[model samples]
Target: MFLEREEYAILRSHVHADSVDLVDALAATGLRWSEMAALPPRDLTLHGSRPMLRVQRAWKRIDGGKALGAPKTKRSRRTLVLSPYLVQPFKRNCAGKQPNDFVFTAPEGGAWDSGGFYHAWTRAVSTMRVGRPRSPPRPVTASPNDRVSTTSVTRPQSHDLSHTHASWLIAKKVPLPGIQARLGHESITTTVDRYGHPLAMLDDEIIEAIEWSMNPMAA
Candidate 1:
């Protein structure tokens, strides 16, 4: 379905098992299409108590094809931790593969290409009847935006998992500097640019704590 959060949840609740895996990897990891496609098997590692992806090289666009390149930005070359939910599927898929093997490969053992992935994704989304386009928000953008129409809302690219993860971290009040490192941003600024401060979920907590400390009588 289109990239809207509600639509995504709905789709997740009902999509086929294979499609669900694809969606989970995309939405939870926030990896770009190419990065996801080019993920090497060796990137998967065991973290504190979970599996993590050691991001290093990324796939770059080349002469009418794709080639290996440095990570997206200097900051993008870092490790990414994943929950057991994610690691289980990975282990199952990686059964006998070598470390140099692509993390997500085609049946022929070739690397994943976004073009093919997109085609498959679109078909899956369509089958699920998710994020169908409707009347445009504005007349001007309607034509371009409604390129794909269904009965529900529009779907977004899977890379939005990065934003989702960032938002979740912010909402949980996770430490900022740590997040910056996890996402491999050159600077916290880069992370902030892509993921703005989480909506102020801490206002009540901060206010209550201040009030309690100020009024000894309440304590």
Candidate 2:
């Protein structure tokens, strides 16, 4: 369900101009939907040696309206490195905004609701035609006697972009601990449990490593 680069590009091209920055930031940093919606201007640090985003609060849906509160977990309150692609967009989004202003806001300059964001996402994705099947990848099969292990691979909703981000990192061979830190997972086990599938293209390398370990003198 993760978007290929071309798919991502197509989707981005179709997103409303005002929302492009917000969507890019979500894909780039894997921020939770709520966290992204509640992001404040003061949380952005673009001039330091390393640009970063401090995830602090999230928009919560209460009885009759939305409310702001601390992130769902203590570990979720962390800083994420900002990719170069995200820097200018974020800067533009913050221009002339007060410190308390949400970095990404609705057309009326208010916290975005899940429904509104989903509608926009649906519109953008509807126009996309360059990617693989949008359904989740099939589970890798093991021996008949072994218990089936399924990895999280679906992007059924926009929120699944977080899983896509983690999958991309895992495919790049980034360590689980590092991915956990970046995604703000409470534990490394959670990161691994959800994204531990070895990418199909990496199978050769995995086999070679195993062979080398078992027969170091053969070559």
Candidate 3:
């Protein structure tokens, strides 16, 4: 399920203060929760000519629990361009911290493990979702402008934020290969499979392009 921009805003507002920026970053960068939770201050280049975030590592599952490992795939180690909105939150997180410090952290301090972050995500959704009796569950066929119901979105996981990010970019008409790179998919096939349905919306642009090619101002 995907969330419209305003819905994302409402979700962010309800998230606990410690996690609000983490949620914002996920929607903005399309980074995996592990990739994001492991980010260190040094990975953020906030003031450069090209403001971006480097995906260097992630918390990978292990026998006992989890550990810092290389990214999920070779492509997952790529860099991501950040929009203007992300800089302030990143800067605030990086303040007075060493290069090795986690950019986003739990309320008690240090990086957020998956379980801890999941609880935070669940709490925020419940506040806006279960609390609103009049709000209807999001129908499968809702129009483009419809607001997302956190409760109705089928038990949203923190990972959905990544999907929501891609949906936002698709709405802006970004190409599939571009979204693949931003999302760090090992192959374009993975991107297409996961996003094919929503990408159908781009057929209108494809038709317009074909029309342009078939005519040269009737000259």
Candidate 4:
């Protein structure tokens, strides 16, 4: 898992349903930060055995700014399994909300203000002091052509959570195809390219299997 045990504890304590949905969206779907931000409540299909979160578009960062656009690739327009743990909370958050609502909208009923999200992230990370690093400052450069103002306070890149989820799958011996599907990766190659290494158990399994196989001859 990308979150250390302590980090999970801190997040569990401090993060509300919306924040947890954000994390689950990343960990389960391997969506980029921008993709998560663009999630529409209408995309949630609750009729399935496992509810699916449809990703219709992803926000793009261009010319030093970001905005919603067609999905970067056809592969990006896939559905993801909404984890069971998140379903109830997500339902609660969406109670009486509009169908087109942004799933992780600000509590004020508006799209998340990036600056505010970063600020809240900073505050949350600050509370999780043990083995967790402080949030970094946002980088700023003059962009007179840019419409979206860059974040003033830098936030740590959160994609590490994707890596963590992938690693957990590999460590748990989940098949590659399954991981690729859950991650909504276009190909197993993408999954392998990003998180291909097996966990410590890979070697241990090989050695233990070898020993067991050889020991049978001694019986």
- Compare the candidates by TM-score and give the number of the best one: 3
lDDT of 4 by residue, 133-180 (tens): 344433488355656543333323466667766776787787778877
TM-score of each: 0.74, 0.81, 0.86, 0.70
Q: Higher-lDDT candidate among 3 and 4? A: 3
lDDT values for all models? 0.69, 0.79, 0.85, 0.67
Mark the regions of model 4 whose C-alpha exceeds 4 Å error after superposition. 16-18, 62-65, 132-157, 197-200, 206-219
Give the per-residue lDDT of model 1 (tens digit) for 1-219: 114567567656665554566667767776766677777778887445867887788888789777898888887888777877798767766678889887677545577667766666666556665544664445565665456433456664456556666667767777778778876777888776666545366678779989999999985
Q: What digit string (tens of lDDT, one per residue) describes model 2 on residues 1-219?
A: 566566677777989987788888888898999899999999999987799899999877789888999998999999988877788989988899999998888876677778888988888867765444333434577455765435433234676678778777777877778888888899888876776563554678779989989996958
Ranking by TM-score: 3, 2, 1, 4
CA displacement after TM-score superposition, residue 26 of candidate 1 (Å): 2.6
Shift of residue 110 alpha carbon in model 3, Å: 1.7
